[model samples]
Target: MTEPVAYSTVWHVVSIAIVFLLGLFFCVLIGRKIGIGFRFSVFLYLYHSFWCLVYFWYAGMHGSDAFAYYNQGLLGIDRIWFGSHAIVIVVSFLTSVFSLSYLGVFLFFNFLGAVGYLFFYSSLRCASIGSKKWVNYLIFSVLLLPSVSFWSSALGKDAISFLAVNLALWSALDFSRRMSLMYLAILLMLVVRPHMAGLLVMSLSVALFFDSRAGTLRKVFLGAVFTLGAVFLVPFALDYAGVKGGANIDSVMDFIDKRQSITKGESSVDISSMSFPVKLLSYAFRPMIFEATSVFGLAASFDNLILMFLFIYGICLGFWRKLNPEYGNIIFIVFYLFGAWAVLALTTTNLGIALRQKWMFSPFLIYLCLSYINQRQLGRLK
Candidate 1:
């Protein structure tokens, strides 16, 4: 039974790859018909090249998550329970193959993440505020953010979650225009990473709030949101039900209460000493003392100055535009930024990523900034 499961998983993977590649070919053909530019080509090529390195790295299985999966796959146990969404099955099956080689796992993660980058760059094109040269400079420079590469370089879940969020937003923009396809696409993606899918849920909720023209049935929206919200809560739900693999749910609850009890006003550093996770919380928010400690991650958030500057400028622009009556892309931007912080604030891992995650926020910031600037430029010409 186990061997059959393993074999079936492999066949499904091969079939999916063949389909995806064929789709990419069609995309390219259509893109050429529409005259896609050289810069997009170069950007994609570079993205692929980095993943190529990642894919070639491990002959042996790696990734903390992959390790658990590899053993399970070896035992011929390949399925995990979830809704009708194919992503749940795909992720599970790939976890089996990813258990085979280190590089393979990262590559798979990279591939899923590339979906989000597609929308991100598209949105950027929609919002580019600077000259072509400045846009190109911003584009290339922002890619250097460490966390961006780190996700592609490791067998981590962040890349795919990131992609799902982007697709949800991209579809949100097109929701009224094509409700069936866009809405289904958003739900399929939301299912892929419901734990971090909050960004999509939150963004779409705001999108729903402002979207008076989307004359959908009220039950449809309510049902979709409620279903996805329950899925998002599943991990916690399972923990509470005592269906566990890694967590000591009771300990976690106790720690949370303890942290709340002590930090009357975010004081009491002693509370952090209570556990490794709490220690991570301290490092996440505090200044780095580079010479003395290796555990706190970086001293402060967003260590890259140029990228940080671009991000801040972009965010300010997004907020200002969101406040304006025109092109309410600002609301989505606000929601994403707010969601990003809220997620980070949930737990602290000293992964040198606090500031780096801010880099993804950079593109959004710049897009809003450019839109405002360019509109003004056109106004001046008029």
Candidate 2:
């Protein structure tokens, strides 16, 4: 039995290399088309790969759900209809078909994230909405974000969700193709995290409604339709989140409070007992420079600080007004970030969950900041 496992492990190593190399080559091709430059794309691929390897290595040594997911796949497609089981079942299928090891499964998901990011950036370029320099900088910054890189480079639902969300953005904005990608994205989110799908639609709808350049009647009609959809959708989403019946504001709040209490005793950091403002602060900006107790914590804190500074600088430079444009892609990002944070802050209790979930919103948050910086530069040039 051990011999069989060891043999499979060797094959898994080979498979990982093949998949990674192929992905790297594909990324280089896509990068050139998107004007990302061969060198930069290669750099990002290597950087993200390093983090992924580190994640897998750490997991292997310390033990993690990687093995659980790998093993679950061996059981052959249980709970296929359940969104949470989707990744596990798919990974199992791939592992069996390819004779993959635990490492192989992890590497494959990392590859998905890397490639997903490429298409995501490509869509932004396709939109032709922001300054090239600014967009490029934001992409680099988001890739460098410790939480974004680490959480998204692992083999888990977070990695898959991250890829799906980015792809959704790309498909929604790219415009070259039909809306198939957008629908696919919605389906993926609904399966994995139903609330996220709701937030995605709500944010996009609200942004469109508020666009000053769109016709009044068009905006009103769109707003009404989206609003009705949300009214029906929210309760369904709440049910999926395990909020019990009716899924109203009060029930959601009750769920949050109950979740906070339940997770408070876990080994992770517990801000459940903190004041609401403090809890929100912790969610948005915690593990401050001085508060960091570990290397990872410090890195996360540094990323948060950098983001906070950029936001402040943009405001001080009077770029906030331009950032909140009446028309353009930035508004979509702004609304999405706002919607995601609102939901995450209220419902999230554990620091670990907060870190991983908030990363889903960082790409847009970073983009908005970069957009402001670009506007400031353009204003100066004028």
Candidate 3:
């Protein structure tokens, strides 16, 4: 008899990476041409935000991650000795304002999701895609997909990560000042989702390596790799050290860990015994799409996985062209996206869903790469 679908389909994740690459390449090209301004950039992103709002509503209809947003913020404030970023603070306050009702919080979360995308689009404008006219409208398709909308502004980890991504992408494209908004955003990510944060940090650093002005010693292309390793180790180190921490993190970790095991064909372990800290990390860094969304009874798609890999390869090919031919942001986007996805793919199969949380700013990333690619065909006079 043949093996199960999961075993036979292990190769699907590779495909996901490739699709992400192709999408990114086109994004970079578009970003460079549109450039940053009040006109084209704002209109496009606003359109995206509008669709994203509709998507959030769709998720509500099906009852998706809405509960997650409502519940996570409560977990945040209910715990002590844990410091949240500016957005988290707002979420915590809203949770209290809503008196812990899931429905009320869901509405608030979707509102923030729309606002988060606004910042994300503005950040992309700061980067500048280059080409324009009708092509700009074409990019809004990112938000037009039923699935994309269903999840776009809905509550949960996706919204949290999108806020961080918005700030990061904006900074990646903006002023050269060390204190840029992106630096703060990256710093916040350190505490939030360290692994993916590190992933993007490393990826962008690689992109910066191609920037000519970035310099080897000062910027550290290897930071993201090291950061990812550290993210895994940091919790255990802290827990072992007897440092004061949250009440829920440990309990949550225990429940999730016990429930989440490498064991195949067996039912999940007890959620109560699993460690809360581990669960927090799992929700934040766990790579298997099926495992993470298993709570929703959502199934995996072999085809989506294939698309991701194709996307990565397309971006990588752009890099092959840029690193040698033009040495622009195209190479940076290619390097960062490939590294982020490649590293995550190695870590686990869950990356398909988890990556979505962080890649909300992917629209911006696509533009960043495309902008640089477009820049290649034009240069200074001899």
The candidate that achieves the highest lDDT relative to the unseen native structure: 2
Model 1 backbone overlap count: 4
Score candidate 1 by TM-score against the native.
Answer: 0.60
Question: lDDT for each of the candidates?
Answer: 0.45, 0.69, 0.44
Q: Which stretches of candidate 1 lie over 4 Å from their true place?
A: 1-39, 42-46, 51-72, 78-106, 129-132, 144-146, 178-192, 212-303, 315-318, 321-328, 349-382
C-alpha TM-score for every candidate: 0.60, 0.84, 0.53
Per-residue lDDT of model 1, residues 1-382, tens digit only: 1111222456456654553454345434433433446456345534643643543343132324434443443445435443223333454465555432323433455555554555555555544434456665665555544435544333344454555555544444455453453455445444544434444455656656555554578646754774576456645533442335523677556544543444433322332334554443343333323322432123233334444465456444443532332334456566665555444443323333343344334444445555555444345311
lDDT string for model 3 (1-382, tens) is 1111211232334333332343234334444443434444344444544555564444555545444434455567544322233334555775565343333344444444444455555543333345453334434443332333334454455555666666665555533642256566655555445545555555555555455565666446444544554455445433432323522566534533432332212232222233544433332233334553453323222223333443454355454443332223444345555554443332322333443543543554455444443344233111
Better TM-score candidate (1, 3): 1
Per-residue CA lDDT of candidate 2, range 102-210, in tens? 6666777887778667765664444335556655666556557767668778877777778777766665453235346656766777767877877777876776677
Question: Best to worst by TM-score, what's the order?
Answer: 2, 1, 3
TM-score, candidate number 3: 0.53
Model 1 poorest 10 in a row by lDDT: 291-300
